[model samples]
Target: MVDWLTVLASGLLSFIVSIASFEVRLRREQSVEESAEVEDWYTETAAHAAEVRRTWQRLWDSPEHPGSNLTEISSQMGLFERQISRHASSGEQLDVDPDVVDALDALAEECRKPSEHSFHSNSNSEFVEFRNDILDAVERVEEHLAEN
Candidate 1:
């Protein structure tokens, strides 16, 4: 009878051990799944950042066109602004730093202001210079976004 009791005890112990092992495996699998999810989020964020940089590059490349309609330019700028706002609102992390956003905002505000018409030859040159400056600011923001 004592031998039979000992055998029963051994079986019970083995059952407990098996249960614990199964639980450990389940926990490990859950952890791996969570890690994979985080990796996917990071990859998606990076892709969004790259897209923002590309848009900035396009804006900078063709800031001033002599023959371009003002309405078209204004529409494009508005679209870019909307895209930036949308991406920032999305779950993806911002590629550009907050400071860059502030700088760009200020530059954009300056560009939006109506220029005082002057007969002076330098007036057009001044406007061109201002546009160039805004483009430069956008480029800087783009570079910062791409680096991240």
Candidate 2:
């Protein structure tokens, strides 16, 4: 009464379905992990930018000579650059937007301006304008990241 061929075919079908389900679940988990990594990277980058801004402000506010903190600011900027580069090159495969890169580049240039004699010696109105430009550039980066 037992049909051997039918039993074998049914067993094969069950095994294939189980394998396919396992693969789908594995891919889904990998996707979630990648997404979380990207989110963390963005959050850290934004915070790093804010920290740079704060340190720059502190340098400007220092009672000591304006150039006193120049070395520290430069170091911080360099570290920030390295952090961005690391994420981009990491095997984790982050999807970086060109617009965000442009925005960050603009911000870095603005950051350097604060240490320049031209910007440092400028009138208060000019200083305010330059500061606003830096803020705008940072906002652009944040907006791009959120959109992506």
Candidate 3:
């Protein structure tokens, strides 16, 4: 009373199910890896922004003895900005806003060519404003990424 066609169909269905499950698991793992990479990039970028702010603070604190690290940090910031731009424009799952990326890029450019007045002044209000703007932009980017 056993039907050979029924047995063959059952076997085929089981194989299909197994392949689908594997595919779902593989996609999930890839998503997690991509998310982790995005997080790492954001962390590194934020750290660089913080360092740039700290360097400006140090310069303001000791206007007569400015360190030579500003150019180096600024260059690093520019690199990060470019990487972020690439990710944002690559049609990837990165939900970052273009405006936020532009803001960060502007900050990087500002850091690269700091105002002489801001550098020599002990108050450094301009630098403070720039730091706050950069932090805000970074926070916005983080928020967007969190939604993914």
Candidate 4:
């Protein structure tokens, strides 16, 4: 006589093992998907940062006097600040070198200070240097992403 109970129990055990194995595989795939999503976000954010830096550089290059429109300058600064804050809030480090941040902050402070004179040679030099620093940071971030 066939041992029906034993066969049924064995079948059940095999089915349970299969289900467990599938569950583990699903979890691993999900983890991989999540990781890819984060990486995509990082790359996109880096690109946006680079674009902003370029825009700032262009604005600085304009013949218009720097302090002529302090309001516009302030608006741009606010936008940059928001961008950095948003990335930080998203749990992604800005990936900008510390030196770059310091240079930018210094430039911002200098802009905020009242100047008796218009754009001096030193002022242009400082602005160019700060812009270059931001570009460098963007390049570093791009390289890091590429390597990963």
The model with the greatest TM-score is: 2
Q: In model 4, what lDDT does residue 124 have?
A: 56
User: Which stretches in model 4 have alpha-carbon errors above 4 Å?
Assistant: 63-69, 92-147
Per candidate, the number of residue pairs that clash is 0, 0, 0, 0
lDDT of 3 at 125: 52
On lDDT, the leading prediction is 2
Full candidate order by TM-score, most accurate first:
2, 4, 3, 1
- lDDT tens digits by residue: candidate 1, 1-148: 3798889999999999999999999999988876676455445444544443454345434568552333444445455455544544442343334654554454445334312223354544554564565466556655645554
Q: Write the number of the candidate with greater TM-score, choosing between 3 and 4.
A: 4
Please, what are the lDDT tens digits per residue for candidate 3 over residues 1-148? 9999999999999999999999999999998988787666556545655665565555434567444444444455555555545544442445444554554555554543333222445434554555566556655545544444
Listing every candidate in turn, what is its Cα RMSD in Å to the true structure after a full C-alpha superposition?
7.9, 4.5, 5.7, 6.3
Error of 2 at 100 (Å): 2.2
Instruction: Residues 1-148, candidate 4: write the lDDT tens digits.
Output: 9899999999999999999999999999988877776666666556656665666655665677542433454456556655654554453333334443443344334333322223554665555554565566556555554554
**What clash pairs does model 1 have?**
none
Off by over 4 Å in 2: 63-67, 88-92, 105-136, 146-148
How many collisions between residues are there in candidate 3?
A: 0
What are the per-residue Cα lDDT tens digits for candidate 2 across 11-43? Answer: 999999999999999999999988887777677
Regions of model 1 farther than 4 Å from truth: 63-148
Q: 1 or 2: which has the higher lDDT?
A: 2
TM value for model 4: 0.58
